[model samples]
Target: MDSLRHHPIRFHVTHWSDDPFSRGAYSSLLPGGTPEHRRSLGEVLDGKLVLAGEACNPVAPAMTHGAWNDGLRAARIAIEAGARRVLVIGAGFAGLAAARHLREAGIECVVLEARDRLGGRVHSIALGPVWVDEGAAWLQQFNDNPLAIHARQLGLPLRETDFGQPLAAAADGTLPDIDAAWEALRAGIDRSLPLADGVARYLESRDEAVRRATRFALDANLILEACLPLESLSVDALDEEGVGAGDRFLPQGYSQLVAHLAEGLDIRLNRPATAIDWSGDQVRVADESADFCICTVPIGVLRDIHFNPPLPPAQQNALDHLGMGQLEKVVLQFDERWWPVSPSGYLRWYDTPASFGEWLDLTDAVGTPTVAGLIAADALERVFAGRSDEEIALVACEALQAWADALRRL
Candidate 1:
């Protein structure tokens, strides 16, 4: 905390774990699971009820665009089925997209959101003059992503982010040859080896210095990007779905995309649906009844909702198999930018892989003197469990200071 005393403006930390509406950050496929599980989960129930969310999207689960695409898919299905009106639960990207597409198709729809806000996991708040995204911020695969296309159509300014070349800095300023280690890891992955086990075995065969750097890079990347522990991630899935070429960010914030989709849609905030009944001819969400119902709630939230007559055995099984990944971010605004002014976006700490392993430079992205520290999975749980805002801010500032000190030594 003393490190940040020199330059301070206003700081805020948003912990999604404490959010009752979300319960967790996003979805992640457990080991021995395929994208087919998500596809099966998206299957329509009773011909009048449908599931539409990131969890249902097989192509890109756990992404805002995935939720948006799934909503569009469900909306198309409802339209083809001759449904006049549809009830959408949750006002996140999925729910908003479904309602917007349905409205465009001339079908009436209503969206019920548990929280007062419109964006579910895509929250953007103003820190003084600049807007910073507290949730889903980046638009991965900008060239092909529909969300990116929509952003362009809406004339939203998108700046290319340096996700490919993240600064790998060590505390003592003596970094190892991580490139060679990464190559060896990739070779092992190509041979169809298990992620955690294979990486561990591969590191043991290498020199001590090389092994340490390799292990740090792999673990840091996995935790920082995947938001899951190395053991929990699937090697096959990772290899199959290779990292996107690049990523783009909205300078203003990602909330613009949600706001754009919400235009002309009937979205009711603070209307949480505790019960859903789709057994009969008409589908009912709580007290309100509609011809068709599209549930876009997250998997974490779905487990809690009471479904009358119970959901199909397959759907229930899918819920049991999939897991939610925990990720936390602490954003601190400074009076002036003290970090490097390079185009690079990320600073990965090799030493503090368990605490704040990664720091994102928002100066170029949002033009604000702000940096966001990211922690994921078990590390996030350990560090942020029941911690107050002051405690979190102190830890975040100290992590930033460590990186700053490392840069100075270099």
Candidate 2:
């Protein structure tokens, strides 16, 4: 649409995870000790020192909405204690949200950000003639997501993603029979429901139907394909009965929401907190100014940075043990529409190495027909880190070609 031409203003975004203050965007935990590590890392040294991040949230950890909720909770706790002046660190959604909540409660507050911009990891980039989301693009599970309410209030239009005919490819230069496989898989997934309700429908004997259905629902291959392992993501999390995974997006930018939230607030940009010194009732932060501190930095930063008097030994251990994985978004623009056979926006190519992930068409999602992205985690770190954009584009193009060949077989 090129609104910048008409509106005379354009949306800009940058990543907070790469910033020194924010080691990474969202929090992701390894398999074991996640619960214990969460409790210890976020345990308040005292009522004066409070911690809030997406990681601190048990129910909805590693999500923007979760981080916002945690910030509000932390601020409320501080406010309840009769703290006159409060400071929120990091100008991302969490910090901005915390500040907004504090302001609503009539508490004096300020937000500190390491980067020059807000939005944290929600970076929106322009690809050729169109703008595309480079980070945290999806507002997943919109039913329970309060962000939608805020979006509506801001007059932001939301739309659902259309599943027009997804294509699949294999890494071995072969295309798995995607349609047939998906049909079988869907049927398998669907048939489990009756088995799930067998106890209620046919109560002839003690039925273990629920247990069997639960096992099938938590299939290993399904979880792997979804990126997370079976155990980390629950079947209940997927079903989310009644709660629609009605994912919605903002046309302007996800960062626009962050910018909108930051308006009418005191936010200091390019201020990275090095250390936290909470000796007295009031916490002190290390920056250009030795002023009141509210440490709202990401957990990854907290783990790496030094703190005076040292965190509790157990907390320190948790910080040391907690590891952050490298998640990357590689975008490419095609010279021509090579994907002729399938017209879907989503394409899953299983044939590529683990480092190479499924190909996604950002055209429908972001109004950019020529653009797409490869969503890979730590697996692609070695490949993506040192490569030039042109090289990356070539690799992506070749991957797509291989994927297309595989699809032809199917």
Candidate 3:
């Protein structure tokens, strides 16, 4: 390692799990769980209520545009049910999209959000002149994404992220071609077995370094993407499909798309709907009665709202079975780029053995002079546990500095 070290001029760390409205980043699949659970969660209850969100969607569960699609789907379903007035809970992509769709259909729809802002998990903040996303950053699978379609319609510029290419470094500045191994990964599966078990079994024949590297690859890709601990990650997770292969970066920020979808909607911010009484013909949420209710509340905190007569056993079971995974971002913006400039949009340093598994080079993506590291599953809890923001930043910077030093030597 060399003497070259750098620290960011400014940074923003997110703790989405700590947020009351969004208990976790996204809904995950656990061992012995089926994707049908999501379909069940998306199902309308008693023809009077609908649960719509990314979690509820089986096709594209964690995507922002998926939430938007679900919202639109919910609105259509409600309209089909002859609903004149609808009350939408949560002003995220799903809720806002549903409200907009309903309004366009000449139906009265009011969106009630817990937070003062729009776009639930799609949060963004201004970093100088650049708008950086603190929550959902990438418009994953852009070509097929509905949100991407909207963004294009609105004339918002999007930069393509080359997720296929990535830079890697070890403590000795040696990086193995783990990408090949990852692509060739095959796990012997059974319903009782978790992803961890299969990975361990597969790595048993490899050397210690190879095993560690594979684990790192899994963490940086699969585990981080799922936001679930290895032991809990479902073996059936491989069955899930994304919108497409296009990964896009929004320079104007993810919120711009959210804003576009939210135009001309009855959105009431900071009005947390505590209860939804759907026992009668019409549903009454927070004292306002509506002919139909579309609850796009994140599945992580779905139980926070009191449902009168209780949700159906199938819906409750789906909520229970579906795992809510937590993944947080630590975004650092520097005065100048300290990291190496390369075509690779992602950077991963295993030199620290393991701290931050994956880093997105915003500098490369949109000339932000910034990088975002994702910490998920076990690492997320361990790193943040008993650590203040200052402490976390110190350690995080130390990891980056180590990586920089190693890369400098190379």
Best by lDDT: 3
After superposition, the stretches of candidate 3 with alpha carbons farther than 4 Å from their true spots are 1-4, 187-192, 207-210, 242-244, 351-353, 364-368
- Flag regions of model 2 displaced more than 4 Å: 1-19, 162-166, 173-244, 287-293, 340-344
Query: Model 1 over residues 1-410: C-alpha lDDT tens digits?
Result: 55554445677787786687887788776665567778889998877888889888877777788888999999988987789989999999889889988988889898999999899999889988888899887887666688888899999988776766777567755877665666667765533555677677776667877777776667565555667787786664454342344677788989988888788889999999889988788888877888899998888788888998798988877776577778888888887887665467777777644678777788867767888887888887677878888688777887777777777788
Residue-wise lDDT of candidate 3 within 1-410, one digit each (tens)? 13336666778888898999999898888776678988888898888899999988888888887888899999999999999999999999999889989998999988999999999999889876577898998898777787888788889888776676766677754776767656656443333556777777777888877776676667666777788877887776755664227788787788988887888898988999889999999899876899899999998788888999798998888887777788888878788887776575677777433577678777855566988787777777678999887567656777777776777888
Query: RMSDs, each prediction?
Result: 2.4, 9.1, 2.4
Model 3, residue 372: C-alpha shift (Å): 1.6
Residue-pair clash count for candidate 2: 5
lDDT of 2 by residue, 1-410 (tens): 22111111122223333556555555555434344665566666666666776666665665677777777777777776676777777876678778898888887887778888887667676656766677666665677777777888988756554333456555554333444443343444433333224323323332454333332222212322223433333233232121115666665668778878888998888877777777665666653322234566777787655666577787766656344334455566544455644454556655423444455565555554453544334334545557665555555566666666666776
Q: lDDT of candidate 3?
A: 0.80
TM-score of each model, paired residue for residue: 0.92, 0.74, 0.93
lDDT of 1 at 309: 72
Candidate 1, pairs of clashing residues: none
